[model samples]
Target: MKNITKLPPVVACCVVIATVLWLPESASLYAQQSTAAACLTTSRHQLSKSGKQIFDIAQKRLNAYLASTKTNRTNAPDEPVHTIPVVVHILEPEGRSLLTDFQVHEGIAELNKAFRNQLPESDGVDTGIQFQLAVRTPDCSATTGINRVYPNNPNYTLYGVTSAGGPGLPYDQVYPMSYWNNLEYYNIWVVNFMDQGAALAAYPTGAYSPFDGTMITASYFTTKILPHELGHALFLGHTFARAIGGGDLDLIECPQNSNCAEQGDYICDTEPVNQSSNYICFSNANPPNPCNNNAPYGTVLKNYMGYNTFGCQTQFTNDQRTRMRGALESLRTGLINSKGLDPVVTGQTIPQGISATLTATGCSGQIQWYDAPADGNHLGSGNSLTTPVLYESTTYYASCLRADCPSDARVAGLVTVGPGLPVHLVRFGAQVTEPNTVTLNWATSFETMHDYFDVESARDAKTFGKAGRVSAPFRVTSGISEYRFADTPEPPADIIYYRLKQVDTDGSYSYSKMVSVRMQEMQKITIGPNPAGNSISIAGVSRNWDIEVIDARGMIVQRLKNRFQIDSERLPAGLYVIRVNMENGHTVARKIIKSQ
Candidate 1:
């Protein structure tokens, strides 16, 4: 992280004064009376500019598509033929631990469920819609595919893209941002993401492609991150941005009201919401309340796009449907009405037990099954056949051969033997000690033979880097295991987040819930003789602790190893974080002002 240079002396003074004046009476009084002060900062400009531009371009494309179609209907066309071609890029240092085929399939399933209102489980809302999977092409080609690439760069964290020049530069020397070129394919890069405030973000409508533009981030790869980013891909912004100022405050979870006031989310359909403080159950703590003198506003925390617990979020509004369709028409023409690429059949054969409807085309005299128990002696003229055998707990494989293409037999997709287990993050004790190190412990339930774990940390919640890894002990059945790791070089100020990654042997992976720790503030100890020329004595309530002196700009100036007295002959005056590593696993941090 780069330090923000201070403004000119006069400018700095003005900013300080302005900041003080802008503080409310309560905050101002607290700052004066309280031992420590909290400051409020804004990143509206830093993070959103790029997103805004991408959205504008997507919006224009959508508008153009709508104008050309001129279709007159109230709702999005039913099961309208749209097949978006997507390419999933797995970016990781140890590429083998990236998402697996099953995980990717699950993610795709979730994507389809959200896109079409076919999710069996809805968040108590009725969205009369359905999104059907487009039939495979005669080429047996799929619109979506996953690709894995290893940067082998240590600098690439588990989150966010790395810049060209930095400590972590060598790992991603040839960064992905530079190689992105295909605009037609929805390019989703699943790498380690970091930053502090947001889980995911997409620019200009959040859509990314091989050509034109791209939106890359790791947060969107897990949970419902893909759907949320896809929403941006289709032209949706944060539901709760202020009408006058372009920023979202609360629009996803609050009480519902019929005020007709355009305050919440700016979209009339979505209910007003409060900020998310915890990730637990879905039912909103605060119900809908009236706003702008309109009807009461209700909470939409359960909406898939809202910042609710993954387990709770599940639906999309009708308005959102319109927005998505509009985007498809305008910016994603490749997604709509793609058929005949693969043929689908529906039939039953004696042994295969409900055979997968085959999609092969001309050039074959008849389809034959080799080594197929019941179908071994049977032959078919059509592309597919259904068997009566039910093998739910067993793996199955099949291939299709054609006379036109001699060496062109297609292998069927891999089918799992049994239901897969749901991966979750489990945390242990939450205590800190000295040397600025925190012992992190965790466990996983519902394990598989190939599963493993990775520990990650972040300075800002938006960006994260791998800290360590723990191979998951295999489980004969569903079970759990406890593991621990330590975070070194603890930061003096700011909160830090830690999380777990469960990886399967086949490379599929899932993320556990995130945990955060705030360093305790030490304000009681005083160790200065104002503008001390040579020596200073650390005197206050006694506590055996080590102290490290840093400059005003967060640079370490000197370290006093367990000593209460220090000679300051070689030091200049400044500000720094006085860090105290406790004997336990926790740490305490305080700001120190030094003058010479």
Candidate 2:
């Protein structure tokens, strides 16, 4: 960050000697503060005498729209949740993964929680905007939303948009090669710069600018940093963006009239104030403004658009939401139609009794399955999926994940399981019991008319006979009803077959696909070839299993759900335990010895 002496004479603000960390000798003037504050004050147009133009135009558009009707703007759909795709580009030297996959994923997750106002620390308005990691790049290839680049020159650096094409011209070349579709995806460049400490953002007017996006130093890649810069990307100026040249600019500059909307920050809700040091969050009792007789600027200093100490920002004002969403409809309308965020896939239609395997083409990464399009534990990964025997058609959500960055949107991919059944059989399985004994498990959802399940058994796959009956739980209108039946055949047999006879309350009945079982076969978990080489085949587990491979030190080396095999080539030569967990809450483990 730049030193105090380098600041322009007209851009005078007191300097706070409050930093405890070391700032690079060549950092930007924006990076003078400690890590707790983002360089939110460093937009290209922010220091311009005419920097507030984005806000000025936004206000007139807002008034004109509010005057028109109660309807949502024609460009944006108000009811359905909107998703803004984000792509993180981490540029660093070779041999270093500066931003780990987990860090990027966690940051994106927190970014959404902040925008949705769901974070525990969030006391601000939910912007009604959801930021998702992009599943596809500009050229339509799958990605983890996190992209890494290694320049031939180890000492490469990128300045903010203000310096994109200047000096060495690294930003100009790097951005065009690294950025996803700007309109479809929000690009955030993460790097370590010789002269930058925190971050800077581009306004919507530059949505198509060659360097259109936010750039932040790696040290400040915290949860709130991106959100604050993105607030500028959506056209929000700093809460202290405007100040008077020392005159009675009271009611005219603050929350007093419509003129205030045309004044400070161009949002009347944010109290107008003169610029203060990067530190000290005003209590509003002592206004940051000095020209208006120290008027009380009633506000929460923790606004995301403020330069207060980091970890202190928690909210966006109501007018801030309007300005942002309004920009989405007007100035930044291109983002609304960007297809970069779509996590679409090729679905499948299978006959009754089989499972469907969906594929997200062009993904050179793991594919994840979700029960819903948003907010839920992932059902499994790799192969896109492995569902239990489906008696009824079912739909699921799928996204390609590279580096833990999922196509983080709630895009649905249909997977038809069966021809069609009245009641949805969400789960169906059989586990071996004592010797030849077997326990059957089945679950159904949305069964308001279901009656009971008649357990049927047979010596072979075809021609079944009744073994027992399990009464249905009181028909739950909106939940799943599970049933279990244990069959103990006379004498210990080698193998047994089982299926469900689902009889409805109305006397209609359907027969589930026959599931055959062998004695002690399904109970055993196997990992081989014992002293394995490249990959290990995990045999004997069904589709509902979750696996965790732990090294001898008890550290989890690999984890994934519902897969028959795992790539063990990368695992260091050592002894490891493969623990298999079933959906019925049953768990078993087996030891594997990897050879050098």
Candidate 3:
């Protein structure tokens, strides 16, 4: 599947509003009100006062764990330590609809970076915490280490956890959390998670239902959701709450409110801001609310622990550091100190240019490759062996083998090469221009074993029936390479999507993001050459509507209310949206065709 990009902020806002409008009345009310005493509301999944009490009990237990650590230095090292083992379970359609190996590694890198304050400067926030990836242990230990599993049923259910199944697929559910034995590792299920507006949601760390484990909605084929959910898996709660009585803060409530003072996310430091707020950089004008104090209502929008923009959110608070440490010390010990992770996987490495040509055979499962010494970065994954290079020297490559159950398990491998090598193909790009020909291009940092490239086009992006094939240049002088192919029989004049399929000598095949292109005759609307040009008649109306002529700046030029004929000899040719405001408060808008 292609990586999903975030919708524009304006578009996202509209989606959110539209979603709310379609929600059930009960759900809407539940999202609006906040109660001091936990009260089960329709929209919120948490129990009312009873649920709050249970959460309080858990909090006390966690607090006690922290207190014990403070008093006894038994397991405490000389320096503050933070480690977490994360497992990603990708649930997809029956025909192996999982994400690429690089996408998975990208997700992991994002998670560790956010936790360790090592994210790219582009992410914006700079938390002071340093998180280190746990080393893989010998004996192929199977604790709470990272594990990816696929189920048979398209739509499976496990108690409270239900897969929101995508279109044309059945929902998958997991029953009895006991089915999963790696309780010690943080279990994160990435699947089709979406609500009305496709907004992402995750349970706070340590929060879990008896029947269902922690499930996070995968926004695209990326790891943004994982880090966000990991935060919840680490015990962070929503930044906004509902207000009850005369309280100054909002508690954890769904449908976030705009009020900042009344909703307390339980974190004393996070400003008591309302829901639906955007991430604003920290400034003297907007200082951090150390205690959620009413007089000082500034916000910490840059904090990763808060609900901020994925790009803008970069840091975790000191309080979050303390809490996460405490949680790791108590409940997540096995996950934090797992023996299966290799230290080489977590540490930084000087990226070497493409060098090695690793091959896989009889590997009926999914294969994943990652860049080593580069923080477990993913390169590519498939049945075949391929090399992918990174621009930065701090990139490492690792790969995992995945397969269908009831069949023999697949074996995966990981290898690293030296710097200055050609970059490998991680993704492909293509655009279909003509019926019989397609334009193809691929993206890769390093190229060592890249045998050839195949150009595939299809009527539907979901499935490519294979239209044409092209051979990739054997020797790539530079870090990047591009190729093209023309199919013998031109595709029909219709919408066609194209993708590049990169193959290795070992027969493993990786795919690139699909590009959509359409070939159609532009419908032309002719206006006048009639009546000696005294007055021109408009023709070719797609729908019934009155037309108005507007200038380039949208100022009304002429209104054609009742007459379709206009004196156009004095008017110049231009473009405009012939808008028809219907009596039903709906508008039928179309582009207008005009003649000079």
Candidate 4:
């Protein structure tokens, strides 16, 4: 990542300070306490300037849409939900800094909970929007909706920086390496933000820029940060943006009773808030700081758009929801209705003994087959795939061999293994029962000529080696035979893929469908003040692991058994990796950006 040079001058406005966080800074910037107030001001201002024409048009369209829906009452409980396809690009240093699948799953889960109003509060409104992991890619292949890139080019991480060469670069120059079609999918880049910013986003303005997307740091990706950024992408603004500039603007009324829509965030339900101070918390134990001039409602501290603490962010107003929906229907219609490429594999559910021919298409290059959706062992490479007699329901996918198109976007074919298959390979699956331990189970009915079953494992689908084997029944019978095997994975192993090889008495054999399980992380540790100045704080675990601070060259500069701060005041600005070695032999490493 490039070091931040200097921030360009931004026009002074009530929201001017709100946009200041995105400015480039050196190490000295870390010493200053950060205020969460008015985080959205900068983007809002930028959009209003660069996209004024489109924004006005979108506002008019939103008014019309809402007016039409006023009498129709669109949000019926039985109405089918609207879904927006999303593609996540995780740019980490090599594979060492990779965010785990479980983490991304949890992040998306939280996003769903917030959007569906599933959170524990009546104020949360269902935004009438659903975010789905894009199943198909631009070349029309299957995908897990997540793309991980360990870029060879270092320039990929300089987000928000312009060509003048500051600590960050514009999204067009920095993010195009992994971005999908902005029209078809909502692109989100999870990287180590150069500015130590929680996140940043671009608002919808009818016209699509290649740089149009949201950028968030990995640590903040799991919080309300997702919805907050999505809100910007969907054309919503901060609830208190009006109070950003100094004073003497216009409409700076109290929250108790005022012209809500015209005064503050342009939403009637959201009370006006003064952005002069940050609200650290909204709980009874630590209430928000007093509102400016003692406004009756204090502030709209609990709204997602407010600069409230992460834990306090809860809901969006009905008007905000209406505005976002209107934007989706108008400016973002391409993303809302896009159906990328087509189905590469097509077939219906069938019994285990049956065979189905699957075809791949829309790829300029060859195609490879995988049993699992994202990263599993490669089954084969060809224009088509024919299945062998199998047990258990399986999802088969085709991958486009185009170098530019690595993630799958083609619709995967689901072959349902019904119970009627005679092989009765009945059940075969794998799971992580505990840290480092994976349990494999399988059952067979009427063993017949079956000799033994070798439980095989692979880090990827292509490499298969025996973990252990279970003996088959000595005699043929109609009763079901159950078998289980447990194995402990060693260091650096986070996920294990397993399959079963059923060998017959005469040495004939058939492999079962692949199943993959992600290992539980030994411990979770978090490092704060990430772009650290003099020291960094570590938490989550009880410091039960050995800590090592390593520089870019893979040399450990400091080691400790149990300690909090890794003092780096004497060190120069650069990228560093903190490796935590647990007594259980599990090793975890995270990338940290240090400022100069």
Q: Provide backbone clash counts, one per model.
A: 81, 7, 84, 18
lDDT of 2 by residue, 1-596 (tens): 22421222111121110011112322443354332332323332344435445434545665665445322222111223556778899887555666888888888787788777788877777777777787667766777888887764544643422233334324445566576656567888887662433564566652355456776767667646677777877767767654443211122233222376666566767765544433455543454344344665455467777666545567887778777877666666556545565544667666566667665533345567788868777888765566777767777877666553435654477766544444667788775533445767787766656678888887534457888888775454557766777777775554566778877777877777666555544446566788888888877676488888989987988898998888999888989877766654454556788888
- Model 3, range 401-500, lDDT digits (tens) per residue? 4332221222334443334322355555333323244445456766655577777766534446777666655664446555556553353644456667
lDDT of 4: 0.63
Q: In candidate 2, where is summed lDDT lowest over 10 consecutive residues?
A: 13-22
Each candidate's lDDT (Cα)?
0.45, 0.61, 0.43, 0.63
Model 4 lDDT at residue 35: 23
**Model 2: CA > 4 A from native:** 1-79, 157-170, 194-197, 246-258, 282-297, 343-596
Q: Which stretches in model 1 have alpha-carbon errors above 4 Å? A: 1-61, 64-71, 74-77, 123-144, 157-160, 163-166, 169-182, 196-220, 243-246, 249-267, 272-286, 290-294, 337-596
Q: Model 1's lDDT to the true fold?
A: 0.45
Provide TM-scores for the models. Answer: 0.42, 0.49, 0.41, 0.49
Worst 10 residues of 3 by lDDT: 16-25
Instruction: Summing lDDT over every window of 10 consecutive residues in candidate 4, give the lowest-scoring window.
Output: 11-20
lDDT of 1 by residue, 314-333 (tens): 77776566656666665554
> Which 10 consecutive positions of candidate 1 have the poorest summed lDDT?
16-25
Better of 2 and 4 by lDDT: 4
By lDDT, rank the candidates, best first.
Answer: 4, 2, 1, 3
